[model samples]
Each structure stands twice: as structure tokens, then as C-alpha cells.
Target: MIRVYRIPFSTNVERVALAAAHKGVEIEWVDVDPADRSPVREVSGQDLVPVLVADEEVVFDSPRVLAWLDERHPDPPLWPRDVARRAEARVFVEWFNRVWKGRPNEMEAELRKDEPDEARLQALGRQMVAWLDLFEELLDGRDYLLGDFGVADVVAFPFLKYGRLGLPEGDDELFHRILVHWQPIGEGHERLAAWVERVDALPRA
Candidate 1:
């Protein structure tokens, strides 16, 4: 059987697991501590969660894993057959990676420390709202990001779900206040709101 090494409740892991379920690809899930490296490290030669092992070949990184899944199981294809549309979808995937990776970095730094920076937090909140606005405009009348359900939607769904949940930074009043700054995207942007619902209704692993 194919094997996947990942941590529970991890967004990236969840994304891949969800994609696998969508493709109806059965896998043996291996839950591992991110801090400790032994077997997964030995297999994938990396410390990252979501390493995919299939027989003699080991695939690391989420995007590559997703692409491999699409290639290995082409049914219920996650990408379009048209070359131009496939390119566009890949471009959007790259943009989403940057947004997801950079969005919470500074906020997470302050959150891990004793003293949180109020001004920085406010700026981050504003930036997140701007992101929501961009997506809202892009999804104005579309059911999915790439005109149809595909890998792009899979990559975007987990983060958008967080936004729907107000991008909770912590369990406190300030976090809720920060959350409120952008939580209205769900109600304000009709298409994106519906997109969230559509993705939320999908089966998961």
C-alpha cells in the first residue's frame, strides 16, 4: 500500500489527505511528531510533514505530491486538459503558495513570544482583509478558482476555511478583534462565501 507520513491537524497534511480522498486514492497514513525524525526522514530525506511513499519511490512536498496523485490517478482529474488553462492554474497555485507562506509568518512570531506587537498585528489583519478582497473579486461569479474544481481549489480551500473561521490567531479577545476585521468576507462576497460552502461539503480523509 502507498504510505503518507504527516502530523494530525496540520493544514498541509490535511490538504494532501483531502486531495487523496477526492481522488479515491487509498493510503496508509503514518502519524509522526514533527520534532522527531526517524523513519520519514530516512525515506524522504526531509523533515517536512506529508511525505508520500509509494513502493520504491518517495515523493516529498505538497504540490509535487498533488501533481503525482493527479498523474497516477487521472480519473476525477484535479487539473484541466487544456494547456493554457493548466498553465493558468499552475500560476495561481504559485501565488497561493506565496500568500499562504508569508501571510501568518510575522504574526506567528509575535504569537509565540511573551509580548505581542499590537501595531504589527493590526497590519497583518489589514493585509489578510486585502487578500480576502482579492479572492472575492476573483471568485465573483465562479464556483471555483480555475473555472472548475481542480488542484487550485484544493490548494486554496484549507486557507479559505481558516478565513471563514476568522483566521483565529489565538484564544483571546484581541484575536477575536483581529478576526472580526476580515470575517465578513463570507457574508460580503457572495461567490467566495458559496465557494467556501462548496469546498466544505467535499469528502475528507
Candidate 2:
């Protein structure tokens, strides 16, 4: 059986888990404490949730794990089959990852705080929307990020979950407070909004 070492509420872990589900791959999830990641470290040589253990081998990194799963289960491929489109998808994934480098830290601080900084949230939201704007423009009349429901969508979907419309369907005050900075792009970003609904409705792992 495939094993995934992950803690709850991790974007990195969510990326891998969602991809596995989308590809119809079953995973034995091992939840570890975020403060103490010894279990994953023993296998991955580093403390990272989303470590994939399969075929007597251990893999780290969400992108690497996702690609490996795609190869291991090709029926519902996570990447495009057309060589050029596949390359294009890889480029976009890399770009998104690169631009999103420091966003998690900022987002975590903002969302987890008892009293989120309105100014900070506003600035963070603006920056995020700018990035989303690029995607909005790119997604003009398309169903998914790369014209299909694939890895690119899976990788970026977790971050968008904190938005008002996408915040986990729960009753946590922090989740509600985080919504302060999150404004729905509904008609302004029509295509992306539709895509959000589609991705949110996908079966999760």
C-alpha cells in the first residue's frame, strides 16, 4: 500500500492527497505532529509532510510525489499527455511555486491569529488577488488552469481554500476572521470563480 506522511491542514499535503484522489490512487495516510516530524524525517531525510512511501521507496516534495503518482497511475493522468502542453503545464507549476514562495508564511500568520491585522490582511489579499488576476486572465473561457483538471490546479487549489467562498466548510472563528481579507471575485473574475466551484466539488482523498 502507498503511504503518505502528513499532518492536517497542510497545503503541501493537500496537494498530494488531492492528486492521489483525482488519480484514483489509494494512500495510507500517516498523520504526524507539525511540531515533531520525526516519522517523515526518518524516511525522507528531511521533515516534510506529504512524503510518499511506495514501491519500497520514499519520495519527498509535493511536485515530485504528484508526478510519481501520475506515472504510477496513468489512467487519470495528473499532467497533460500532449508533449508541448505537458511542458507548458510544468512551466506554469514552476512559475506558481516560485511566485508563491513567501506567501504561506504571511497567510499562516494572518489566518491563525486571534485578531488578524486588518492592514496586513488587506495588503496580503491585494497581493494574492494580483497573482490570481494573472490566472483569471489566463483562464479566459477555460475549464482548468491548463485547459484540464490536472496537477496545476491541484497544486494551487489549497491556497485558495482560505477565501470566503472556499474556506473549509467549518465553524471555526479563525476561519471566519480570515474571511475578512477574502473577497469573492464572482463576476469580476468569472472564469476563475467557476473553476473554483469545479475544483472544490472534486472528490478529496
Candidate 3:
């Protein structure tokens, strides 16, 4: 059995779990806290969660983990088969990891601030909205990022889900609009939603 070192609330870990589930791969979950870096470093010689350990192979980083899983279990493909579509999926995954790092901090400020500083909150909201608009433009008239559910969708969904839950409290309309854009590609889509449910049902490690 494959062993997955993970943090339950991490979007990165969720990406790997979702992909594994999508590929019908069962993984032994190993929970590790961010503060407890020793166990992770001991396993993979690095301090990152979502490390996948198989016989003689250790994969760190969520994207690499997803790719590793896809390569090992090719059935129910996580990536688009078309070359161009695959490239697009990779592009979105990169953007999510690199460009969206500030989202969580911004969201935290927006949600937890006692006085709700309008300037900071609006700036964060605008930044997120810009990304949302970009996603809308990319997803215009399409059901998923690459016109089919794939790795990009799985990688991107967790951030959106986290943002909805953590940020912009009392903004139902905003969240609803975001969900409307996300739902068809996320919860409303059978394959993707099933993957989500499977991940959700997993025992916390």
C-alpha cells in the first residue's frame, strides 16, 4: 500500500488525496502537523506534507505526487490526454501554487479581523476577485478548466473551498457567485464530487 504523509487541512495534501481517489488508488494516510517537521524530514528528508512513500520511491510536492500517482495508476486518468489540454492543466496548477500563496493570508485577515478593515479586506477581495474573474474567463462556457475534469480542477478546488469557508464572512452573494462558477466543475460534477466525497470520507491521518 502507498503511504501518504499529510496534514488534514492542507490544500496541497487534499490535492494529492483527491487525485489518488480519482485514480482508484487507496493510500495509507499518515497525519503530520506543520509544527512537527521531524517525522516528515525523517521519511522524505524534507519537511513537506503530502509526501508519498511507495516501495523504494518517495515523492514530495503535491504536483509531483499527482503525476506519480497518474503514472503508476493510469486508469481513470487525472490529467487530460490531449497535449494542449494537459499543458493547460499544468499551467493552472502552477498558478495555484505560486501565484495564489497570498490568498490564505488575505482571507485570514478578512475573516478574523475584529474591526474588519475595509481597505485591506477590499484589496484582498479584489485580488481574489481578479483571480476569480480570470478563472471565469478561462472557464467561460466550459464545464471544467480544460473542458473536462482533470488535475487542474482537483488542485484548484480546495483553495476556492477554503476561501469560501474562511474569508468574506457574511458575503453570501459573493460566495454564491463563486460557488456557481465552481459548483458545476466541483460538487455538481459527478466524477469530481465523488472524488471529493472519497477524500472527505478518509480517516484523518
Top-lDDT structure, candidate number: 2
TM-score of 2: 0.81
Single out the weakest 10-residue window by summed lDDT for candidate 2: 171-180
* Prediction 1 TM-score vs. true: 0.83
Residue pairs in steric clash, candidate 3? 31-205
lDDT of 1 by residue, 1-205 (tens): 8798986446677778778888998989998965687878888887887899998889988898999899999988887889999889888889888764465655667666798888887787678777777777778677887787888888878766655655445433433334444446556777777788888888876
- How do these models rank on lDDT, best leading? 2, 1, 3
Q: How does residue 65 of candidate 2 score in lDDT? A: 90
- How does each model score on TM-score? 0.83, 0.81, 0.70
Q: What is candidate 3's lDDT per residue for 37-79, written digit by digit as tens?
A: 8889998998988889999999998889889988989988988
lDDT of each: 0.76, 0.77, 0.67
Q: Which stretches of candidate 3 lie above 4 Å from their native place?
A: 102-125, 166-205
Winner on TM-score (1 vs 3): 1
